[model samples]
Target: MVDQVTSILKEYSVHTDNKMNEIVESRKRVGHLYDMMKYHLGWMDENFNLSRASGGKQLRSTMCLLSCEAISGDFNKALPAAAGLELIHNFSLIHDDIEDGDEKRRHRDTLWKVWGVPQAINTGDAMDVIANIAILSLEDTVKPKVLVSIMKVFNDMVIRLCEGQYLDMDFQTREEVTVDEYIEMISGKTAALIEASTGIGAMIATEDADIIDRFKTFGFKIGIAFQIQDDILGIWGDPATTGKSAKNDIRNKKKSLPVLYAMQTSAEKEELKNLYRKETLTEDDISRIYDILTAAGSLEYTQSMANRYKDEAMSRLEGLYPGSEPMKKLHEIGKFLVERDY
Candidate 1:
């Protein structure tokens, strides 16, 4: 069903682009700025090849569509919200790579890497503006009162995203990050958009208060599980699916879930502390940190926590809607979010 959803999402992606032009298009005057937005969307690239990695997976858009249908609402009514999440997510990614000094995104050079940080920052800002514009299309698709309420929800989520990013950047230098802190950070940085994707989709579909809360709780829990799983894979999962080895996160001094778990457990917190305290971490030190993190069972611990969240999410989902094909797809995809290496 995820594959089927992905199929619909690709169709929606093209359609969303066409709809966006209705708002963003001006003559050749602002073409360069428009092209920058397109470039980040994988419509244009530095090498000028259309070929790119699976551009964003469109998972959020697909979720919006599915939830809309499942909740007994018209799927087309949710298109603006679907496109909104996609733009919001891509905006976050563009800035995330720039802030992390990451050179690659989806198997291609990140905008910051190819174009430089200053322009990359501007480009991400532009994408965010586009995201806001995308949501306004709801004015046409939804009732006026409903549109205002949903737009407020979308705006609030974006603010939370910034808070998450703020904490993530702060974690870089902080020596005493906890597992709890990691959860909060990901909730803002990674989970907010995801939660909104599912929640807003439900809003477009149904007016039941209980059902909306169900979708919110479900998306929130799954989002945490997804990031924890990603962090674990970043440290110990296979490289082919993850694009980063089990050792990559440590090499970058990332304060991910497992790393935080290991930090407080070891009597040698001092040792772990010293390794990360260095100005420049060597390749050799990264190997040693991985060994310590492994010995501390950080990967296993993180995986266990992911399972707990997935269970919680599934339970909430079970209450909202009964067993059905779409629900099964949601269940499968939700579990896969945590269990899969990629």
Candidate 2:
């Protein structure tokens, strides 16, 4: 189903791919640094060998181009922005893997693990700079005034993304993180980028702020729902499919939505709390936490919240581009985000 939704993006793949390659190749003076970026992007390996390391689903870039097409805009004109959004998304992921001490991504060693943290941080920063450069290239494709406005939106989103990451790391140390706080954190950490992708797409495609706002709203709501489902997958998804243990997030003591909900509503809150405080959790302790989470109905609660957000996203999409093929594609993507199990 997601493949169906993403098929609309097939048209823009070459454009975005070319832009990504160009961005990485632009800094030939820092060849080694760009090699790291390419490695992380799965274009090459740590030894610069050609291998098929998955570079993720490129969801942000697809949404950007789709949002542009939804407004009857030429997706080719939006290619730079699409590439920019993907770069920013990957930039965040590179840093996030470091912050989370994640050793692997896509079943390969993370950039930070392969390169030291300092070098990995440099590569992430380079990706961000490349992202900004990519967005600025839109000046040739869009009106100068419009490009400036889009840059403002892009810059503002960068700050929010960092703030959200800050809050996420902060939650790990604090004993309590309310559901509301978790929502706010994810709004910045995850949803903001998605919103920017859709919002920038609409911004480039049309001059109507109203339509742009609608796209932003649609992306934001669906992004929240997407992240919530990811949280669920972090806990209960099959490791074979997800490529990580179901208990991975729990072992890291991530304050995911389900855990927060369970902490607030579970009768065994104290036990769960004590379990979290421990430096290490035994297998039995992980099972107990799962039991408590289930007993508290946390999974259902999280899914209900995700469904509510998806409903809102669909409503916004309807208003944004009624009965259009692009709208249908966007709607299907939203459904896939919520419905994907792995």
Candidate 3:
């Protein structure tokens, strides 16, 4: 399934990348500002030399284009939206790294770490504007009414994404966070854009409100599952595969699902709370926390939750283009999101 999804992504990624590059490169040069954006996109090195590097999996954009292709039998009409979604996702990542104090991404120095926070913030803002511009390009391809609808969805997604980020950061300072609160945070922070991606794609392909709603729900459910998988990987993923240290989430004192569940149900809740209150944690502290979470079955609980969402997401696709290859690929992508090691 992984290989199948990889092949599907490879088929679409080239066109998506080309669209993004065209949008980025067509801009007026402004004294290394664009260079920073390019660097962050893995198109150039810090020295400003062109280089081929992994930007990311392009999951959101691929989903968007795939959704369109699944219904319309073509993805070209969705290219602008795909490019816009990818740029929006990356723009959020730049700001998120600064806010979270994460110095590394994909094994490279983060944008803020490499170029300083002020410029990085400016660069992120520029990328966001560029994303908006990319979406506006849809005016040439889609009807004005359709263009307006896509813009509404895109702007609403941006608002929800910001709200989610706020809740996530706010959770960092609070002593306690409920599972429902965590779900709300991730719904905005991680899932809103994904929902918009598929929803917008379906809009481009057809005017069937029911079909669009199904795709939106599918994206939303899978998006939630995706974040759960991410939280799992943050705590237990291999450093080599994830490009971060062991138990990096613990090192950063993140209140992810596992920690929250253990805090609520673990026999050693008091000790765990005390450990989390410390200004800093040692290797021993991290090890003990790991044991507590494991003993409390937090990992199993988290995985079960992820599977529940994944199953719900799959249900949205039943009977929709029953034998379409793109639909099958979308299913594979959903499984990959929950099962991927990194």
Candidate 4:
């Protein structure tokens, strides 16, 4: 599945390159600031030396480009929008890591950890400005009306992303977070940008409201499912491959779907609550939490929900493109995200 996603992304390597090049060029006046952003993007080292590591999955950008290509004949025209979406995603990640007190991302120290919180906050703020600029760059490639529509959608997504993040932070202390509430939080926090990506892609490629609506639905469902999959991985994934500690979320006592499910259904709810209230968790606590999660069928329930969303995303794509390669690739990507191990 990793290779499959890599193959699909290969078709749009230039878009990624152009996006990075633009980011680099956009920061010529502030070399230090650029270095901070570059390091966070996995493009350079702390000393400003270039690195060969690929930045990220670039999943949202790929979906945007794919939606454009599926509707029209090319995705290059939507490069700026794709870049903007990627920037927004990374911006949120920078803030999220700070909020969560995470130390690592992609196997390296997070920006706030390496550069201090104030600088990291400023860098994230700058990235938000640059992301808006990137979207406006679409003015050169798309019609004025289309650019206006895309910007409006992008703005709404940004607001929803903030609301989702707030809900997520609030959930950390709120013991009564239900499954439905978790869904709403993730829909805003994780899925809103993806929804914008595909929607803007289709909007750029065509003017058909129905098609754009379908694409938005596709992105939203898959985005939610992908987060649920990550929650499952957070508890049970192989730390070696996942670049995270086993039961990472358990140690943090995050209100992920699996934990919430266990809280609701496990016979050990009182024990789980008592454990979660501690300031620190030992490996023994994590293991016991895992046992409680498993005994409550949390893992199975989360997987079932992921599958349900992926299935619905695929269903929405049906007849939208018939047998086109882009449509097929979108379906494949949705499946891969939900089913991937690492």
Candidate 5:
């Protein structure tokens, strides 16, 4: 799947390069800022070195093309939007890592880790600008009205992402967290952009409001399932397959789903409460905590929730009648995300 997506992106390099080159003329004075962004993007290093595969999965771009195909539209016409979605996703990641004080992503040092926080922040800001500007490329292919819809979806996605980030940070301080808030927070932080990517793809394909609505719903459910699975892996997954420490989230003091569940459980709630207030939870503490969380069925509960969302999403997609090959790919992708070991 990765290779296939890689090929599609390689085949569409003109769109990527054309748009990036176009940004140069309008973005002078901040030229070094753009250079930093490019380095982070894997185009060149800080010392002006070129490399390959520096960026991650480009999932948003895949969603864009898939959404178009599901609607029986030529994905070729949607290249600009495809690139725009990918750019937006990457822009978010660059900012998200800094905001979370995360030092690693894609098994490498984060942009902020390599550069200072201020430069990384500005670099991320430039990427955000580029993402918005890239979306405007749809102007030539679609009507002004449709363009407005595209921008609306993309803008709302960016705003909701911020709101979700705020919720995640806030959750850290509060002892109490509802399941509803977790769902809503992941929906914004992780799912919003994906939902927009697919929904915008639908927009590029047709004018059917009901179809677009369903796609938006589909994207949200997929995003939720995707995030839940990530939470699951963050705790129980093998470091090699998952590309992260087995207890990374636990070590970082993250209030993930399982941790919250354990805290709220009947059997092991007090056990969780006893250790959670420590200045720094030791490895023994983490082990004991993991035991309590598992005993409380937090792991089971999280997996079940992710499966429920996956089933719901697939159910909706099945109801949508027109199951094109691209739609099948979307279904398969969702299954892969939910069922993946890493």
Candidate 6:
């Protein structure tokens, strides 16, 4: 299953990256703006020279294409939308780096850090515009009504992503953030794009509303689980694997699921709160917080929640296309999301 998922990711990544590159290179003559976009995408170096750095897993785009193939057996029809999904995801990442004040992504200096915030914001905005334009490439392939529908879904996803980002930033400043609130924030910030990825792919493949809804729901659940896994990694992941500091979330005081759960349930909740309140946390402070969270079973609780969502996501595929290879691959991908270390 891992090998199958890897093959699917590699196959679709090449397709999606090629499509994205074509879209961006169409305007390469426009100068450093496009270069900045390419840099963030890992296609170019900070100095505008070409380089092949890791961008990410390209999971959303792969899911988009895979969902389309699972339904219609013709993933080619969804290529533009898949590329658009990836570009928009990167757009969010660019802005997110600025918003979070993150210096590095994928072990390299973040776009904001390299080019400064102002130009990075402009580059992100341009990338977003290009993402919209990328989807417009589908106009010649799909019917006008279908194109309009896809546009609506795509735009709604962008709006939700922004709202999620707003809530995430807002939460950072607040003293208390409930688990429910965190879920709501991530639904918009993280899950909306994933939902749209699968939903739009299904839309491109078929006109069946029921199947589309199921795919969207599957995406939403998988996305939730994906974020939970990320939250888990944020604290416990190996820095060599995750490309971030150990206990990075605690260092940043991110009110992730485990921390919130520990705060609510741990006997050491007050001490945890006090530690978080400190302007700076030492190595000892981070270790103590880890102990408190572990003692409260926060990691176990978070992992269970992630698995629950993943299981639900897998359930959505049952009876849709029984025994289909693509359907099986989707299930594998869902499992991988919760189980991935980075």
**How accurate locally, in lDDT, is each candidate?**
0.78, 0.88, 0.93, 0.88, 0.79, 0.92
TM value for model 4: 0.95
lDDT of 2 by residue, 73-186 (tens): 467788899889999989999999999898988878999999899999999999999999999999898999999999999998999999999999998889999999999999
lDDT score, candidate 6, position 244: 81
lDDT tens digits by residue: candidate 6, 1-342: 667778879978999999998888888477688988888989999888999998788999999998999999988889999999999999999999998888989879999899899999999999999999999999977999999999999999999999999999898788889999999999999999999999999999999999999999999999999999999999999999777889999987889999999999999999999998999899999999999999999999999999999989888877988888877777788888888876
Candidate 2 segments exceeding 4 Å error: 6-12
Itemize residue pairs with steric clashes in candidate 5. Answer: none
Better of 1 and 3 by lDDT: 3
Q: For every model shown, what is its TM-score relative to the native structure? A: 0.90, 0.95, 0.96, 0.95, 0.91, 0.96
Off by over 4 Å in 1: 1-29, 47-53
The clash count for each model shown is 1, 0, 0, 0, 0, 0
State how far residue 291 of model 2 sits from its true place (Å): 1.1
Best by lDDT, which number?
3
Q: Residue 85 error for model 1, in Å?
A: 0.6
- State the lDDT of candidate 4 residue by residue for 124-174, as single tens digits: 998888889889988888899989999999999999999999998899888
Cα displacement (Å) at residue 29, model 4 = 1.2
How do the residues 155-231 of candidate 5 rate in per-residue lDDT, one tens digit apiece?
Answer: 99999999998999899888788888998899999889879978898899889998888788888888899999999
Give the Cα error of residue 299 in candidate 5, in Å. 1.7
**Which 10 residues in a row give candidate 4 its minimum summed lDDT?**
12-21
lDDT of 3 at 134: 97
For model 3, where is the 10-residue window of minimal lDDT?
Answer: 1-10
Candidate 4, position 124, lDDT: 94
Stretches of model 4 off by over 4 angstroms after superposition: none
